[model samples]
Target: MRDPVDKLSAMAIFARVVERGSFSAVAREMQISQPTISKVVKALETELGGKLIARSTRQLSLTDEGLRYYAECRQILAAVDAAEHSFQSGKERIAGHLRIGSSVSFGRLQIAPRLAEFLKRYPDIDIDLQLNDQNQDLIREGLDVTFRIGELNDSGLIARQIGITHRVTVAAPDYLRQHGQPQSPAELSAHNCLQFNLLNSQNLWVFENNNKRHEVRIKGSAQSNNSEAIREMVLGGLGIALSPVWLFSEDLKAGRVTAILSDYVAQSLPIHAVSPANRRQSARVKAFVDYMSQALDAAPELKPVR
Candidate 1:
């Protein structure tokens, strides 16, 4: 039996094993032996009095109990991370350069607007903000942290859901007045939909009604690879646009852009703060992500509409 101090390490190893689906993978990543990894998991299952993983020759899969346990483990690890940060603040300024990657529109309208606060809080830390509307290899780009909006499939990466963001269909009141509003997702096909040419909503828009999903294929004369450009075209009365709500939240409230088809649920795209999977996250990276999560939670624009 190991000391109580080693129990947390074992729990983390168990979580990583479930995440990676291979004992060897976790062992290689953690720089520990394969037997040590197996022993940790064995000890965990022994302590819990049940099997967490149903291991086979090919891969590992979590049992029902394991799935529930994994969720609790992740929550506990996050709380431990926060507790660690709370005590380390009085030491010195968290001085480091953060190379962050994000979408151009989100970096400009959302993240950039909040930078002054982060900079003010961490005077010694500097940020290298790279804004592009495409996915880049995190390690190859040498980024300290990157914010992505979809599922994190890589076992080598860690994801944190900061808040929820969803695709919103919007139109300038003038344009809506001219063409009349789309009463349903089916009506959008007849409208000149401004395409962002990115993500799932590029040439297709998705909605939910009566617990059934509707995917509408749309076309328009104007298509932009950038989201902000799509916003500009929508504002110009070029046509209606399906965009992230945060891009035009204030406009929806101020009546500049009208949100139609309220009965159908717009596609849900939850906001995420992703970083490469590491047992220890840097002070600057941790601080920035935590601050962003808090900021996003408080923002009315990023919230999902019922």
Candidate 2:
């Protein structure tokens, strides 16, 4: 039988060396001699029957075998840590790491502010938030949950629809006065349309009129991948923009921008909390989703745009 102490020591040292990229760094961190770290690594490689790392005087790199081994080792270590944490916390409270993925605007304007409240309610839970406009692969990235603002296209993931987000065409009063307002979707072609480049149909603005939906292809002088930047530009009277009403409700209400094409409204996109189907019942995952759902329901700023 293998010695548990030796196995743990080997795993710990391996992880440290991989992270630090050198045996000397691990030795300095552990306050042990460099030779001792090397010995442990060599022993681990022998036990596993694979050369996990290629070491040199200048640099270190993992072999293909090492990369695969490290991936498995990391997962195993995380599971062990979670198990220990669960035992210590008595399973009554939400604990361990909860990684969340969300779009930049929604994450910043809505989700992030409520994070402190969540922490206060569940002190044991640690949150790691990743905010970007790009859609990420949740399972591959090891995310516990994600906030998606539009239609979910991934068939394998489970999505819980929390609320709906309306789309609107908005522009500064100055821009509308200077350039003239668009009375119909066709007239939008003559105006400077500020486009959000991340959307699947970036050039097309969808509008609904009397139960009929119309998609108008719009040309824009200004375009950006960042949604916040687009909103800022629109607020500054650079051009008209099509975006979710929730993103610009404050601006709309404060008279910074006016909603146009009011007669031809767009359909509301459902906001969803998505996760891998397999982890739908996970305690930490469920806790976060529930917390966010409640927080959103109570937030006055998230009210539907009329």
Per-model TM values vs. the true structure: 0.66, 0.75
Question: What are the Cα lDDT values of the candidates?
Answer: 0.80, 0.82
Worst 10 residues of 2 by lDDT: 84-93
Model 2 whole-model lDDT (C-alpha atoms) = 0.82
Instruction: Tell me the tens digit of each residue's lDDT in model 2 across 1-306.
Output: 199767866886787688677888888868999999999999999998989999788998999999887767666665665556555346634677788999999999888988898889888888899898889777545577899887777988898988667678899999999999998888998989998887777898888889888878898788998889999899888999988777888898899999888899865677899986644345677888888888777766566456
- Top TM-score hit: 2
Query: Candidate 1: deviation at residue 173, Å?
Result: 1.8
Clashes of 2: 0
RMSD (Å) per prediction: 10.4, 5.1
Off by over 4 Å in 2: 1-45, 51-82, 87-92, 137-142, 156-158, 276-282
lDDT of 1 at 280: 46
Q: What is candidate 1's TM-score against the reference?
A: 0.66
